[model samples]
Target: MADTNAQEDFSKLTADLAVLRADVAKLADTLTTLARSQGEAAADAVSSRVRQGKAKAEATASELMDEGRAAYDEARERAGKIGGDVTAVIERNPLGAVAAALGVGFLIGLLSRGR
Candidate 1:
C-alpha cells in the first residue's frame, strides 16, 4: 500500500511540473510578441519625426536663401547708383578729379615709405 501511494504521488507531481512548464513557455511567447510590437512602434515614431525635421530644415534653408538673394539684389542696386553718381561727378570735374587722385597717390606713397 505504501509503494502504491508513493507512485501515485510521483505521477501527480510530474503532471503538475509539465503543466507549469507549458504555462511558462506561453508566457515567454507573449512577452516576446509584446516587445517586438513596442519596438516597431518606437521605430515608426522616430522615422516619422526624422522626416518632419528634414522637411522643416529644408524649408528654413530655402527661406533663408531667398532672403539672402533679396538682400544681395538691394545692395547691388545701391552700389550701382553710388557708382553712377561718382562717375557723373568725375566727368563734370575732370581737373579736380585729377588733382584729388594725385593727392591720394602722394599720401599713399608717403605712408608706404614709413611702413
Candidate 2:
C-alpha cells in the first residue's frame, strides 16, 4: 500500500516537472520573439518614444538573461554538491553507488541533448 502511494506521488511530481519545463520553454520563446521585435523597431526609431521603448525592452531582456544565468549557475552548484554527496555515499557502498551513478548519468545525458 505504501509502495503504491509512493509510486503515485512520484508520478505526480514527474508530471508537474514536465509541465514546468514546458512553461519555461514557452516563456523563453516569447522572450525571444519580444526581443527580436523590439530590436527591429529600435533600428528604425528616430523619436524619443521608440528609443525609450527599445531601451526598456533591451534592459528587461538583459535582466532576464542575467537572472536565468544566475539560476543555472545555482542549479549547477547544487548538482555538484549532490554529486559530491553521492560519491561519498558510493564510497561507503561501492556497488550501489556505481549503479546509481550510471543511471543518473544516463538520464542526465538524455535530458541534456534537447537543450
Candidate 3:
C-alpha cells in the first residue's frame, strides 16, 4: 500500500510540472509578440520626428536667406548714397579734400609703424 501511494504522488507532481511548463511557454510567446510590436511603434515615431525636423530646418533656412538678402540690399543703397555725398563734398572743396587726405595718410603711416 505504501508503494502504491508513492506512485500516485509522483504522478500528480509530474502532471503539475507539465502544466507549469505549458504556462511558461505561453508567457514567452506573448512577450515575444509584445517586444515586436513595441519595436515597430518606436521606429515609426522616430521616422515621423525626423521628417518634421527636416521640414522645420528647411523653412528656417529659407527665412534666414530672405532676411540676409534684404539686409544686403539696404546696405548697398546706403553705401551708394554715402559715395554720392563724398563726391559732392570733394567737388565743392578740392583744397580741403587734399588736406584731409594728407592728414589721413599721415595717421595711417603712424598707426602702421606702431603695429
TM-score to native of every candidate shown: 0.87, 0.45, 0.75
Per-residue alpha-carbon lDDT of candidate 1 for residues 9-110, written as tens digits (9 for 90 to 100): 999999999999999999999999999999999999999999999999999999999999999999999999999998999999999999999999999999
Q: What is the lDDT of residue 32 in candidate 1?
A: 100
Q: Report clash pairs, candidate 3.
A: none
Model 3, global lDDT: 0.98
RMSD of each predicted structure: 1.7, 38.0, 2.5
The lDDT of model 1 is 0.97
Global lDDT of each candidate? 0.97, 0.94, 0.98
Which candidate number has the best TM-score? Answer: 1
Against the true structure, candidate 3 reaches a TM-score of 0.75
Error of 2 at 42 (Å): 17
lDDT of 2 by residue, 9-109 (tens): 99999999999999999999999999999988887675678789899999999999999999999999999999999788888999997898899999999
Comparing 2 with 3 on TM-score, the higher-scoring candidate is 3
Model 2 clashing residue pairs (backbone): none
